[model samples]
Target: MDNQRRGFPKRCQCGEPVVLKTSTTAKNPGRLFHGCPFGRDGNWYHTFKWTDTSMVEEIEDLIEKVENIDGAAMTLQKGVNACESQIDTLAMETRVHLGVVEKEVEEMKMQLRSLKNIVGFVMVMVLFFMCMY
Candidate 1:
């Protein structure tokens, strides 16, 4: 018999379909079983069955698998967050290094301009001396 059929009783003593309810206790957390709704009023004309131990065990196993998957997802999220943080830090460092390089390039351009002016001045002086000679 299937776990669902075994776990769920077909009919109550009152000729109604048994309602499924989950056990909330520590020993049977999330365990699915059938109960007679009419039995809630302390009537003795109700049926009960907890012999579907395989179904409860299967449910517990599935719950554990889900919890493991959730844990893995959390771990993966943390790794992604760490990678993002590292990327941001590296980007900031790269920006700072680029700024320094840009400043150095500008200074080199200024020095080259000064050197060109000095060379032009020396050439003019040489030409003037040659013209006199």
Candidate 2:
């Protein structure tokens, strides 16, 4: 089984519970971070470095960072929102294309049935002519 506890839970650095908006990775390993809405201007929490011992201190530092990094956090938020919008658009388009393909498949089935009926009729006519002969 995979070690599911890869990072710390979504909490702030100040040992105070902050509302977590989202979680994203950073350039460093074991340094995943979260965005807290409790900052002075609702900025991103600092990148929390995870260690086995000082998890509390790490969470506090992250809360302070979130209070500090306003510009960087706003950029990240915009990027996330844009990507989500694009994904929603793509999902809708895919659903529409799937519907069209399903309709075509149904039409093809109907055509196949019609062709089978015609072939059956021709076979019966040939048998009748043979009997007359």
Candidate 3:
């Protein structure tokens, strides 16, 4: 049954159903594969792989290249997303810090104005008493 023709259904060890493709060979026989539906589980329950015959090797290489490109794309997208999030976070933090600084400056200005008013009132009081004397 291992040498069965391509496109045939084969039973997995766990009783999962899989289809053998046209890439089976003599040496590395019996590899199963499936689409993205089974990708998360780390085992392709719906398909299998075989040895590297000349024809199979060419096809395998092409498939490997395609998968590599896909993986690189995913990594790049993830990196970009991470960088964007970091930038947003920094912007928010900067805005909050600026707001705090502005509030502090306003408070200091008010205090200075109050001190000036008190000094001016004391000077006028002294001048009035001195003139009377």
Candidate 4:
């Protein structure tokens, strides 16, 4: 990976550009090394020791760290999305509750008006009885 990122080395003795390939065997999983592109034709130029194991480990470690950071960022984004959805749901609930409260208030106002009319009629009846007496 590093070699690909930095660019391939100069041509081998076979006059073909070396290719960087990762080892996939259980013994050397994820190990990066270089090889001659024409090695299958018996040119056989290889450099397994060009990069030290420690260097390969360092690069692998950096790659793992980057992957972890990306995973964490995705998790945080999902949490933010969930919070926003909850906020929207609560806002809707609050609007519905406000509507119900407003209706109750209007009903109370109508009841109060009816009570006031009843009280005024009682007062007038009392005044008429007093005049008669």
Candidate 5:
């Protein structure tokens, strides 16, 4: 059973209140744990999880969370990169469109200059013919 998911034991499965105690066994001397008062040493029927083991499990869960966050971050980074690429493409397109508009403006300026010269020459010829008559 995953006792780690259950977290710190408040009550035993046997419907008895758990209390903190120290292990007196040779294998685990002075180890703190929570268990029912009715629980016996080396008994598997009762809840008797080691405190240190529970903490280790907690740390493992945190590591898994960090890994999940890292994966999410990587996914977000990919999205940002795609957005940047799209922006670059749009910028290039804009520059090309602006260049075409600028060329048209230059052409219009040259046409305006030619029209002005033709108008000035016609006005001078009209005045000279009127004076001759």
Candidate 6:
């Protein structure tokens, strides 16, 4: 039986349509099989595959497909986790940079205030010198 074979048997190797029939013997009673009517005619070469075997092969194939899908999903989840980690790192870097920029802006404001004071004193001295003259 081929594990890759999917679904039930539709036709036998003898080019005859398969039929589902139950066994009625002491060795294996009430067992189901998919076989051709010609297969039961006391022929040496006949198709007599068990329905249970085909079902088992089909189930095996479905299990393999499910396992492959699960593996792909795990890979995608790992990629998503990596992207989230990178985003967190960038966010932290941006916060640190913003803090540095704000401090620089405050320092510039203080320097401007000092320059204004110096200019006001220079203007007063010029006025006093002119009054003395």
Highest lDDT: which candidate?
5
Model 6: per-residue lDDT, tens digit, 1-133? 4433355778777888889989887887999988788886467476776789778877888899999999999999999999999999999999999999999999999999999999999999999999999
The candidate that achieves the highest TM-score relative to the unseen native structure: 5
lDDT of 1 by residue, 41-60 (tens): 35657855554664666677
**Candidate 6 similarity to native, TM-score:** 0.58
What lDDT is reached at residue 131 by model 5?
93
Evaluated at residue 64, the lDDT of candidate 1 is 86
Mind giving the per-residue lDDT tens digits that candidate 3 earns over 37-84? 232334654334342342465576678889999999999999999999
RMSD of each: 9.0, 19.1, 11.8, 9.6, 4.7, 4.8
What are the per-residue Cα lDDT tens digits for candidate 4 across 15-115?
66777767677987887766666554244454333345536666777898899999999999999999999999999999999999999999999999999
Candidate 2's error at 56, in angstroms?
24
**Measured by C-alpha RMSD in angstroms, how accurate is candidate 3?**
11.8
lDDT of each: 0.80, 0.64, 0.64, 0.73, 0.87, 0.84
Regions of model 6 farther than 4 Å from truth: 1-5, 9-50, 119-133
Ordering by TM-score: 5, 6, 1, 4, 3, 2
Q: How many residue pairs clash in each candidate?
A: 0, 6, 6, 0, 0, 0
Per residue, candidate 5 scores C-alpha lDDT tens digits across 55-84 of 777787788889999999999999999999
Worst 10 residues of 2 by lDDT: 1-10
Which candidate model has the greater lDDT, 5 or 6? 5
Question: What would you estimate as the lDDT of candidate 3?
Answer: 0.64
- Candidate 3 lDDT at 80 equals 99
